[model samples]
Target: MARITTPLTNTEVKQAKARDKEYNLSDGEGLQLRIKPNGSKLWLLNYSRPYTKKRVNLGFGKYPDISLADARKLRAEARTLLAKNIDPMEHRDSISNHQKEKIENTLLNVAKKWFQVKKSAVTPNYAEDIWRSLELHVFPYIGKRPISEITAPIAIKTIAPIAEKGSLETVKRINQRLNEIMNFAVNTGLIHSNPLTGIKAAFEKPKKQNMPTIKPDELPDFMRALSIASIKIVTRYLIEWQLHTIARPSEAAGAKWSEIDFENNLWNIPADRMKKKTSSFRTVN
Candidate 1:
């Protein structure tokens, strides 16, 4: 016949003194209170694997942090796993891994991961703008939610307030970014379909407005002002070049002397430099 271990009380556990050597106070069924020489009390479970029959020690936690009742509950759950022929530590690890994966698949997490890959292709200022928009508009509502849980309605709701504020352009841009993120999730196997696809149609279309520009009649005065203004010579020349060639400010700024075909009276803007690749050259004359 095997000797049975007696159950311990909370009072005995609390008052248990530490000695030169570490010792355990049994609470029956493998749960024990380990008292260390430094007076630290820890909860531990000693159990044998059902398959291999090898003994294992499972840490419940420190005694005060994990109350007696909680330790017993954990021990009972561990025993339940043992009865099912599963290792308790392995089961705990599986549950932890699942939770970690869930956190990693959250809308914000997935969006950030996608942003890391995208930021390299865009300017630093544009990348900062992308994150700023998300932090202000998208993160408050659905960022923490798992990507798989995001629905079309939720996505619409997230941007509806911005649309209602007459920021239709912002709404459109946010929707575009969300579409990219959701598409990334799909490609990565995190989701089956993009919930934000076609979501832009739900918002009001932005009104088109032409950029402010000087009228043809104002050109003489504009040129007079430019020539006399307290501006650098290079800047004045750049302005004159843009006005004559009708080139965008960016194209004019990036123009190299080598691309200027002075012999032919032509500014041969490279295909790569032209906004529309088809338009290759402009007659400077």
Candidate 2:
């Protein structure tokens, strides 16, 4: 059992010397408190390993910031860990790693990683758009900073300037993308909090742009013009499918013969081929 020493007083703490100077406590445990002229106090615990008998310095409290009570608590904890046959340094490192993992799961980092993984899955043009919004508008100010460091105020600083420029639609689209990315980050353990949640006026609902359509009266001229322009049969058929079935351009161009049933004149596009959500195949006659 360790014996108690006289209580450490402030003047005694001040008179403590550094390097060559030492303020030795009565317990004779070689527990030294070194005080610099600047009044900064630091503790060093000297002890030997059980089997090796090698001397080692266990670092402890620093100055007034680490009160005597706190230092005692820390020492007690260290002793407990040592009793359990654990190295105090290794235990501290494990705690630090846990804390780092917790912080890494924040919304910002998770979103960035998610974007990196999914970005390649999108078409080149769409990927460019997503990257452009994030890099130009959001990443410059916030990318390298830790996600926990990004408060709602900081997030607003990253986005509000773009929102102010009458680009509500653009802002809305970016916000929605940001929302999905952040949500995914949460699901995958990247972020604990979604900064987008508390932001007001951070987004406006996007107005649906009516798709372009060609009237039936214009069809003959259009087909004739396309034929005169020497469009290939495949290209012509692809365009016709886009017009009739309201399929996206990529979907029409990328359709395979294997997906078409000639007997029923029905084309079945599998869910994987869809540019939109949902996985069920789409059919067109």
Candidate 3:
């Protein structure tokens, strides 16, 4: 028959004097109050591994620091793990490691990592714009949060104030940059999903405004003013080309001789050069 030890009480533990040697007063079911020779009281739990039957002692902290009730709650949690054949110590270590990883993988850290890759692909000025926007708008609220824990509501809330300020265009650009950053996180396995996905629906849709242009009668005066203006010959030609071809300023500026076919009277603007990808050709007549 197994030796049965009497369960210890808080009063009994308090009244019991510490001896010259360290001894544990049993609270039954693997929980004990260990009294040391120096009079310090510590809570400990002794349990066996389900697989190897190896006995292990797990500390539940100091007696006064962790009350009797708290110690029992911790012991119960440990026993629950034991029943499932899981080692409580190892489970606790895993949780600790996960929290540490989360702290290290903050949104700012991941965004910086993603920015390093992105900066190389864009011009320095554009990269500066992206960083400035993130620092001004996104960082204040959620930058320190774990990337994996940033949900759609968090992302929406971060940008809502900017949208509400009637900076709809700025909001759109920031949203695009955030989406790209989150996508990079997903692709790199830092996060499982992009929280900024479909985030545009949260904001009011921006109304489209057509580019301001001069009337047909006003164009001759505009051209006459351009001819007399002390501008470079190339600038004069660029203005003429824009007026005649209705090409955007960027398209007109970036035109090369190779793209023009004199025989066909056509300018083959590549998809990359055009504002829209499908607009590949323009009549040059």
Best by lDDT: 1
Which residue pairs in model 1 clash with each other? none
Every model: Cα RMSD to truth: 5.2, 9.4, 7.3
Those runs of model 1 whose alpha carbons end farther than 4 Å from true positions after fitting are 50-53, 98-109, 119-136, 139-151, 186-194, 204-243, 246-285
What lDDT tens digits, residue by residue, belong to model 3 across residues 240-284? 998777887777888899999999999887666554444467788
Task: Flag clash pairs in model 3.
Answer: none
Q: Which stretches of candidate 3 lie over 4 Å from their true place?
A: 16-21, 204-285
lDDT (0 to 1) per candidate: 0.88, 0.67, 0.87
RMSD of 1: 5.2
Per-prediction TM-score, please?
Answer: 0.67, 0.51, 0.67
What TM-score would you give candidate 3 relative to the actual structure? 0.67
Residue-by-residue lDDT tens digits, candidate 1, 1-285: 987988888899889999999999999999999999999999999999778889989998997899899999999999899888999988888989878877889999999999999886664446777899999999988999999889999999889999999999899899999999999999999888987788888988999999899889999999999989999999999999888888877678878889888889888876655544544688897
Q: What range of 10 consecutive residues in model 1 has the weakest lDDT sum? A: 270-279
Between the candidate structures 2 and 3, which one is better when assessed by TM-score? 3
